[model samples]
Target: MDVIYANSELICSTNASINKCSRYKGQKTLKKEVTVHKWIKVSLIVLSVCLVFAFGGVCTLAILLSHATPLAFFNSDFSVPVSDQDQNATDYKAQFDALRHQHEETLRKLNRLNYSTGCALCAVHWIHSGGKCYYFSKFKMNWTQSRDHCVCLGGHLVIINSKAEQDFVNSNVKVTHWIGLNDLETEGHWVWVNKQPVNDSVEFWIKRENGIREPDNWTKGHPDGEDCAGLGHPGGETDFWSDAFCSLEKRFVCEAPAAV
Candidate 1:
């Protein structure tokens, strides 16, 4: 009878230990699950808040968040890993710059009234982008006339330095607008309003379907040939540039540095 009691006590003790271990493991699992759930909730809230802030015309919140940390925009260190193996970290500076530029441009388009009516960095009726202010003309003028008008407004004809600037102009203009590119001094040698030679790397000339490239110096009427560059020709084509007679009256875009 003593042997039976001793064996029963051993079994009860073993069962009690097993129960304690099981309870501990269950609690541990519950804690891990709760942590994951909380992380997910916070992620959702951050994304929703960013969207709301951006749409409310206060996208500077997004910028501030980006500047907070190198990984604030991507969150690799504290993010929950879905895979057992580690994921490679990527350099997203280029992508982040592009996103920020696009976001600012989108905001300008969304609230043109506020931006155009009054800007701290730009004049009333001018729009700011990439540290520059642009004035899109509402009236038509010859190339020389337009250039002079832009000068009168403390600016020059728009000079496109990069693809981003080219894209910005493309998005803003609806009709064929005269650009800063011209070959007036030396035919076939295009120059910008800043007197800088057009970089072949960034030129956006049109290639004809037959494989012919522009600056063909095709003359419409004048003996000097087409000396001015115009983009988005009406009803003929859009998204490519063509040389036109400088005497032709057309709308133009002016560019100037933003106020300090």
Candidate 2:
């Protein structure tokens, strides 16, 4: 009886030990499954974050490309060499300067043309004839004063050198006017204002019908000696030069070179 009881106790102890071991193994398997599931979830989350960042980068690049100008894309300095760029800038500047010079030259030529024409170059109320400009003054002044006035006007008193010029002055004068011929320095030796001696051979002095010549210095019996010359209708003879007193106030003619 004792032996049988011993064998049964031993069998019961072995069964309890086996059942505890089986339960421990089942718990370990459940822990392993939970760890694997956690690893899979973490990997899936990382992949999703990577996919989102890649898509956002692509969209930002596309937006930038769309907003950029066509020229901006082509204007990059890397496409052209530095020396070529400098050469192009120099060429462009040279072309601009050339065009500016051409424009200035054209303006100068137009101004010269306007100045060279006869009547167009003369001042208002001035007459142009024989490459000269003449101004007939309406006011009266003494011979010296008239010469000074002509000087102030950038000219001198009329110096008639030919019959045609004498005729022109005689025909244009409204009344007796002072001319540039005078013997102010030495009496009876006539000279032009420019200091040239007058040639009496081709002189335009009026000759009377009785063969008497003018410039007789005859001014109503008062002979301080007429030193200044004038052109007018003296003795009913027009287009003739006559010596007159320097102090006599008379209308004058001024002459200047015509602008060319």
Candidate 3:
């Protein structure tokens, strides 16, 4: 009986040991599975965040590209709507055209008035469209010097505001008379005595080959670096102008005008 009991006790102990080992192994396996699941979840979360950021970046880039316009003329490859720029250019051109037309009408009215009502012994030899009369000086003058003379005479050097005025000046002056147009105030932006912009289309007559260096426009020789302008006869002939010195004596034109 005692031996049987010992055998029984030993078998029971062995069974208990096996069950504990199995339970421990089961717990360890569950723990490993949980760790693996946690790692997988963390990896998925990280990847999702990266993907969202990448997609957002792509969307932003696409949006920017859609708005950009190609500017090939200026060597800018990007494309963007140039509607505003075009509108601005159009507005400027319209303003310039209107100003030119107004100048023309003003001169026509002056011519009609002059024909009806003549002047004194010193008849109006020249008529500026923008309300002025010009009497070419019998002497020559440099640009600055001539301008000063005009100011003293209570006016400015004659500014050819239109083709008609230019033609008129060309007809009256036998020699080039110092006029008010010059790039002296701002180089490359030629302005008349009245500070009006010289139209690029109306080519001012220059001395033969005088504008060789700057082939874009007409420029008479003689008063180099003096910022002077002169008038010429109708046949593209330049007759008068002076350098920077106002002291030099030359023929001058006086101006007066009928009311517009």
Candidate 4:
């Protein structure tokens, strides 16, 4: 009976050993599987990171290429050539200069026309001839008073400087008119209202064939004392200027520069 019991105890010990060995093997296999699973997850994470970086790099390169100019890439100096642009700028400048010249020429022509046609610049009822404005007075006044009136009207007494001007005055004046020619400051030294001495270069005094000349200082009471000159009908010619007393009242003509 003792032998049998000893044998049974040994059998139980062997079975327990076998069970412990099986449990150790099962735990090692589970640990190895868990380690392999962890390594696989880490490898997948690294590969995903690599793919994300590669996609980002590709997107950045595309954006840079989209914004870059084609000419900048083609030229070695990286500067745009200015041949066409310079030619266009030169053409524009030439066109502007031509327009400016045309404008200046048009202004010059307008000024010339204004000078040629005096009536274009004169006021109503004012006659324009030889680049001068003339106004014929309707009332009568003395020489000094007439000059003062003309000055008040922004002009002076009519100063006859040429035969054309004299003819114009003769055709316009309906009655005797006081002129600007006078020797009031000095006898026989005639000067215009503008203080210019009367010279033969611009003189328009009428000369008669009968040995008589105009501005003869021909008045009844005063001979040489007749200082003021006037244009009137005196016997033979109707467009002759004669000196008369300064106090005598007569119609007058005023002259001024033509308005531009």
Candidate 5:
């Protein structure tokens, strides 16, 4: 009878061990799959950007055609939201990356704003100041998604080039918002969405309390450190630019040339 009891206990322990091993293997497989998926997305972003320079902005996104049937099934509705599709949607990703790369090249060569064409009226839900039209979105999105959304809406993220512009944007700020500034290409070298490097002469960063520094790389919020910029709310020394995680979802400000 004692031998029988010992044999039963051994069988139970073996089954438990098998279950644990199976679960561990399953978790590892899931993690591996997620890593591969992330790499694929990153590859797509690079491919889209390179394709823009190669094709000179003439070619359209190929993935858009893949969902032709589904796209055509729904009628266009512009009022719902600026970014109705998922952030991974290729239409805006392709356009945004292509537009960004093109702007980077053109802004460097021409040293000009590509979309700031003529003096124009601000559209509904947008503010007019300094001869530029700025839009404050109610929805929130990550830095990359917000950047792409601005391009989708015929503009880019707000580029506060001067104190006047900064003050104007600051006064109207209802909450923290994403700006066009980022150090994605190179750490510590901040640049605007227009590809213009930050002019060190002017400064408006979050107040240095206790001398901690504004961009203290808080939390490694971004994969390459705190690579994105966020505009703080209206407060003494608080209404300024601060580095934020690129993955953090925040409201964004969009800037464009006034329509004639």
Candidate 6:
């Protein structure tokens, strides 16, 4: 009976040993599974971080590209209060508006002062030296004849002094009345009948031909060595003149100071 008991004890001890080995093997397997789960979790977290960083980088790049190129469709309407931008836009707009208003006012004043517009005027018998008339006659004679006639009238042909005055006279002349201008006295050195040097800079001349006296100085080819300059209505055209002889018959444009 003791021997039977010893065999049973041996069998039980063997079974317990086998159970312990199985438990050890199961524990090892569980440890491997936990390690694998931890590895997967770490990899997932790293991937998520990378994706967030990549998304943020792409968004930043997109914004920078939009700023550097014309791809941005949004126009800052400036209706919003400026926080980071230059704040002078409003001030610049105000200054521009003020300048525009001032320009308009100046133009109004000029229009009131000069009711006339032309490059030259005829029959300007009045220069208001405070207010008085300086009388003289301008014959639409050839350059030479015009000079002689103006001299006879006790004054030389008018010399265009200013753009405004020139335009005024030219507009009112109604004919290309002879003025105190001719290259005949000297080539290219045009002088008024009063012998005042012609200021080509102030008034420009149109040239049809080349190689004369400073074609830049000639107003549509004046004083082409013609002895006469006649201003009269020719063939129902606005009166303009060609070089002619003084013997031709035509009306005269007289000028004098405005009668007080």
Q: List candidate 3 segments past 4 Å from native.
A: 1-131, 207-226, 232-236, 239-250, 254-256
Supply the global lDDT for candidate 5.
0.78
lDDT of 2 at 149: 90
- Ranking of predictions according to lDDT: 1, 4, 2, 5, 3, 6
User: Which residues of candidate 4, in runs, are more than 4 Å off?
Assistant: 1-119, 218-220, 233-237
lDDT of 2 by residue, 1-260 (tens): 99999999999999888999989999999999999999999999999999999999999999997796757656865555556768999999999788757655754565578666532455577787766679999999999999999876767898887777777777787577888988889877889888888876657766778887767776576567788888854345556777888888988899876654
lDDT of 4 by residue, 1-260 (tens): 99999999999999999999999999999999999999999999999999999999999999987797766556655444446657889999999788767655764565687767653565566788877789998889999999998876667899888889989998997678888989988888999999998878877566778988767776577654788888863333447777778888988999876644
- What are the runs in model 2 whose C-alpha is more than 4 Å off? 1-120, 219-223, 233-235
Model 4 — which ten-residue stretch has the worst lDDT?
76-85
Assess each prediction's global lDDT (C-alpha) against the native: 0.81, 0.79, 0.61, 0.81, 0.78, 0.52
Off by over 4 Å in 6: 1-140, 207-260
User: What are the per-residue Cα lDDT tens digits for candidate 3 across 108-143?
Assistant: 676676667763222334454445657677666655
Indicate whether candidate 2 or candidate 4 has the larger TM-score.
2
Worst 10 residues of 1 by lDDT: 82-91
Clashing pairs in 5: 120-259
Tell me each candidate's TM-score. Answer: 0.53, 0.52, 0.40, 0.50, 0.53, 0.34
Across 53-79, the per-residue lDDT of candidate 6 in tens digits comes to 999999999888657533232344443
Give the number of colliding residue pairs in candidate 5: 1
Q: Model 1, range 1-260, lDDT digits (tens) per residue?
A: 99999999999999999999999999999999999999999999999998997787666766675467645524556454323223323336566567757655754564565556564367789998987889999999999999999977767899988899999988888889998989899887899877899998998898888998787887656677988998856565646788888888999999876643
TM-score of predicted structure 1: 0.53
